[model samples]
Target chain A: MKILVCISNVPDTTTKIVIGADDKNINTAGIQWIINPWDELALTRALELKDAGKISEVVVANVGTAITEATLRKSLATGADRAIRVNTEPADAWTVASNLSEVVKNEPFDIILCGIESSDHNGSSVGGLLAGMLDLNFISSVSGLDIENEKLTVQREIDGEKEILETQGPVLLVIQKGIAIVPRIPSMRGIMQARTKPLQIVEATSSESMTETVQVTLPPEKGKCKMIDAENAGEVIRLLREEAKVL
Target chain B: MNILIYTETREGSFKKQGFELISYAKALSGMTGGEVISLAIGEIFDEELKKAADYGASRIIALEADQLPDNRNLSKLLIQWIKQANAQVILFADNNTGKAIAPFVAAGLKAGIATGITGLPEKTDPFIVTRKIYSGKALAKIQVKSHYKILLLAANTFGIKNDPVVPVIERHNIEAEYFESPNKIISTEKQTGKILLGEAEIVVSAGRGMKSPDNWGSIEELAQILGAATACSRPVSDEGWRPHGEHVGQTGKVINPNIYFAFGISGAIQHVAGISGSKVIVAVNKDHEAPIFNVADYGIVGDVNQVLPKMIEAARKIKTE
Candidate 1:
């Protein structure tokens, strides 16, 4: 079995996000980037399957500009057999999925995995759009997965319930954090090996973006917190109802 | 112009977010001078259908089915209805199910799609909307230049107001073909007799400061008294002290409750991102300098072990009064 894991390069979660001077994008100065946390989890799972011999190879794919190659190299170092970088600045989820669909049509893989949503945009649309474009069965919010003899079983969350689902081969999954909670770190040996591995660059075929970013702004600053004495705990409830009017 | 809203149902009743979507659609229709039409599929109740009318649906379309199919199947069914109604704009709740299917439907219609939207369109001429990006750390105003548009409204961003109006009900007996999906539901497990965390107005959450899972009893009791949902920080869930469903953070479920009470939790940037959209935030932590205090509307510098019991007692007393 061959697996394709879609990866995204996003700003570190702890980075202080500052809107650019133009107010159309984020400030890039002195900002650290990392593999999208959820996608890291998905990649870790794919590597585990490869280690178990369930998968013959793991191919990591990303849709972004040239700068994203650094992140793809990190994924390769983390254990992907090879990496494919679709050269494009992802304007929207539709554009990203369209480019990915072009790659999926060329690469034959038994399973396609992606983070349920990118931590940056949180659009949660690409995986579904890709599945739609390719006419493949898709599952979202997957928490558990198992494969046996080309058959797959998945556990997905719905509202307040967990649904255990069974499927056949060649499936797409928008995975949440369950298969592997902790992400894998690149070993020294793996880093050396990744430099010799294939880092293929494909020009984006889809040029149309359905949505355009008009501006970016921070949320309005909340008012100062009213500090209450711990001794008078009852006042907290009163304030919540009267002053805050939320209770 | 005709606007279509997908009103999703669990079991036979509409979810609370469904009404919120209807309320939002009504406002959008008012702006565009369009008609609001609701489409529901599966085993639906008349009372639920009436609720949609009460909210502001001008017309309701129902498709009866024995089971709710997967997202791919549902999207196929929706495309047929969308074409039949000739809807210009489509809306869905930004929940698990909506996130799964809305994109598929949008792709099929060749429509521009936006999810996690925080506000109404600033301009509808070219159709521009605002949504949170970088997890609530920043908001982006997006313009969709397409013939058709799809949007998923973020939870708690819009208030649901009842504009009670009778709606015309139309039953469509259409034979929809379902794809041969590799996915099959084998079993389901539900958290019985508890308000769903996603829809709760008030949420009480805890972190590692609570010490152990044994200490969660007081948190649950307080949540019960206030008719609120119980949530946890990522560390608490990672430690297996709480179910993953109750986890609220950047990597977990993004919540937008009216009031979010953080007990014994240091505010990490990831956790703050999830609750930034909340209306009122209250933090109770022993460390007064905790980062959570930066975004909180109310702060109590005390230990959770001591403060929680007192707060719970005060809440119980107020309820009895």
Candidate 2:
């Protein structure tokens, strides 16, 4: 079965967040962007499945303006069979999901893979939202997915148990960690080939965004870590009880 | 206006997050002048279903189902009652189950939503909610323009309260095959009786300073003493000193415990991304300049083997006093 892995381009995880002048977004100056770490893992897993002959094709898709093409090219270089970019600035998870729905429905892919949450917005909703819009089965927090002997099984982390789930086709799995050990790097040969790979751009249907950011602010500045003498560990406990009150 | 909260029960009992939603629901109700009506869809018990009343639910709607449908089907089912109540606002716990269903429900209702909301709505004039975003380093104040709104409260953020109210319980029956799906549960590996790291209010995590996997007993003992969960850094898990499930970092599980005790860990930015949501962080490391100390609210300059036993004994003695 063909797989469509939905990826998000997000600021690097270590980027120090500085709110922009508009108070609604981050300062884009000198911000490094990459395929979101989790989605990178998803693309890695899909390519692995394709390599194993269990999957027919691996297509990577993202919803963002042209700025997202670099991340999509990185996906192609890492061995996605094709790349699709939905042209628009995603306002919210619903808008991203709606645009991705158009791309998924246009393809014959049976499975869609999404990162559990993007490190940037961290909404953890786009996968399920798209599943609802497309009337496909939804599973979240999936740590493992395999297609063995033409049957699909998924490992989902529930409250305290790991549920092994078996399903037919046409499912969207919100991938958590453990799907791929280490994300694949683009080989020199693959990078050269990626230039000629199809980078399809689709106009966004521009569904109404369900939410909008009013303002973004950093947390209140706090005091530095209070150091205590090693010999006076007991006093630290007292401070926890009386001062921090977290004990 | 009415607020509809989707609550869940496990083994016929409510988990801490269940009441947390109640706490959030109560706070949301107070802010918006909305009554808190809870909806639970599962094998709810007669006595267990009434627990929400103690937490100030005005009325409880229980949908008893032997076999719960998948998240998408459950969304369709919930859309029924969500509209029936004409709820202006909806609240859900931002966990595995809630994340799976809440988004679909929002789509069904065409409601504006904010998941993993760390606190109550900042404003109702334009329907704004504040949530942790971008690796917990920033807060995004989101404005939901839709007439209906959905908010999923994060675990351990909203404090559950004891507000007594005699709630009316309305029971409904749902069939096992309510929706068509082709998914089956194969097996469940249950980590019974152990505190899960995700929901853990207190977490005791260690790094390579322990030196080997053999020293892990102390970490588990310390976690047991504090009724906390045990976690490790990515390197420890990568080295197979601990299971991947116990690893917390940018790649592994991200945790937001109330108290996070880091023993011997020189905090990497990836590790900080995971625990950055924590309210209070305590670090015990020999290196005074370790990056872990930068984020830690409290720190001790000491070796893990020596400081760990002392902290355990002190905590044991202090708890009794």
Candidate 3:
């Protein structure tokens, strides 16, 4: 069974997001792009499964323009067998999921992995939308996944509980953290192989989005933090009770 | 116009989220000139079904949760109800369940979708709604081109308003063969807390600055005095110092409590993203330059050992006052 990891190229987590002068999108100038933290972890887990011989292939796919290839190259360097980039600017979750569904159809993969949400947009919808478009079974918030003797068992968080579920057939998992300990760093040999590895660019199935971003702006500025002296530390409780009224 | 809200219940009873969703839908109805219709799936007790109307639900419908085995069936059932009620807008709580299911419903309806909606539409003419982007770092105004709109709301973002209305409640049964699924559940383990972290009005969280798990007792003592929930950074939970259920961050649960207390946490953007929704934040960290202070409303530079004890002592005085 082949596994496909849906990846998104997003700004590094540390970047302080600012609206560009365009006023409708985030400023991309001098923004360092990286594989979304969750998606990178997803790709890492896929490779782990492949290394364990539980899956035959691990493919990293994305929906973005040519500039996205840099992040895809990083995925390739991290041990993804190949990479597929659908040519388009990933505008919204609807467009991204729709276009990626077409790619998944053309290249059959038994298990598909997606992050809970991208770091930049935090839409948290692509995997579900993609599952609907393909009419596939989707499991969300899957923190643990194991396949043994051709049987798949999943541990999912629901409300305040952890529920164990067993499932089979083609499955799409929207995974959060804990599926993998940490993202894999590229090895020297893997980095060299990534230079010549297959990175396929395909036309997007659709460019339309159901939603349009009309304006982008920063959140309201917060008040300066009041510094309380260490000797007066207990005063905070009085302030929280009288001023903030939270206690 | 008709608005649909999928109201969630816990253990056969309505919770804070259900009331919040109903109240929000009612507010939306005023703008859209629509009637609010609430849909309760699963096994909600009969009495709780009636209170949904107290928060402004004009009508309520109950569907057996077992009939719809998975999210796919749940989405299909929602689609069926959307058409039946002629609902142009569907609302869902942006918790774990909503995170998993709302996108599928949007796909079926071919509607524009927005998650973590913070406020009402700035204007209804173009159907624009505002939500947090970049995990609460920024805001985006989304224009829904499609007539059908699916919105996932973070509970408590919209305050619950009590505008009581008489509701028509009905139980609708699904066909036996709506879906034949293969997934089987094995077991479930629920870790109940003194206060459900998501619903807590105040939260007290700590990170590596605590130095050791043994120091967590002070954090809990403060929380007990304040009637707040105890939470920890991801690394604390990952290290087995706390259960994963107590984890609060981008990878864990995101909450919008009335107030949040951070002790010794450095406030990485990921951790800050989760707590930024709180009404107020107070940080106590030894590092003066810790990033958590950037967003905190108040800051204290002191060691946890010294500061935490003072905090606990002061908090114990709240009841006496």
Q: Which candidate is the best by TM-score?
A: 1
lDDT of 1 at B142: 92
Off by over 4 Å in 2: none
Task: Tell me each candidate's RMSD, in Å, in order.
Answer: 1.3, 1.7, 1.8
lDDT of 2 at B233: 94
**Better by DockQ, candidate 3 or 2:** 2
DockQ for each model: 0.79, 0.73, 0.73
lDDT of 1 by residue, B3-104 (tens): 899988777888788888989999898888778999988778887778898889988998887677778888988988888888889999988888899888
Task: List TM-score per model, in order.
Answer: 0.98, 0.96, 0.96
Interface RMSD for candidates 1 onward, in order:
1.2, 1.6, 1.6
Error of 2 at A165 (Å): 1.7
Report residue B46 deviation for candidate 3 (angstroms). Answer: 1.6
Tens digits of lDDT, candidate 3, A128-233? 9999889888888888888887678888876568889898858899988778877899999999999999999999879889999999998887889999998788
lDDT of 1 by residue, A139-224 (tens): 88898877777778888976568889998768899998877878998999999999999999999998888888999999888788
lDDT, residue B121, candidate 2: 76
Q: What is the lDDT of candidate 3?
A: 0.86
Q: For residues A79-122, what per-residue lDDT tens digits would candidate 2 score against the true structure?
A: 99889999999999999998998887787578899998898888
**Model 2 accuracy (lDDT, Cα):** 0.86
In terms of lDDT, model 1 sits at: 0.88
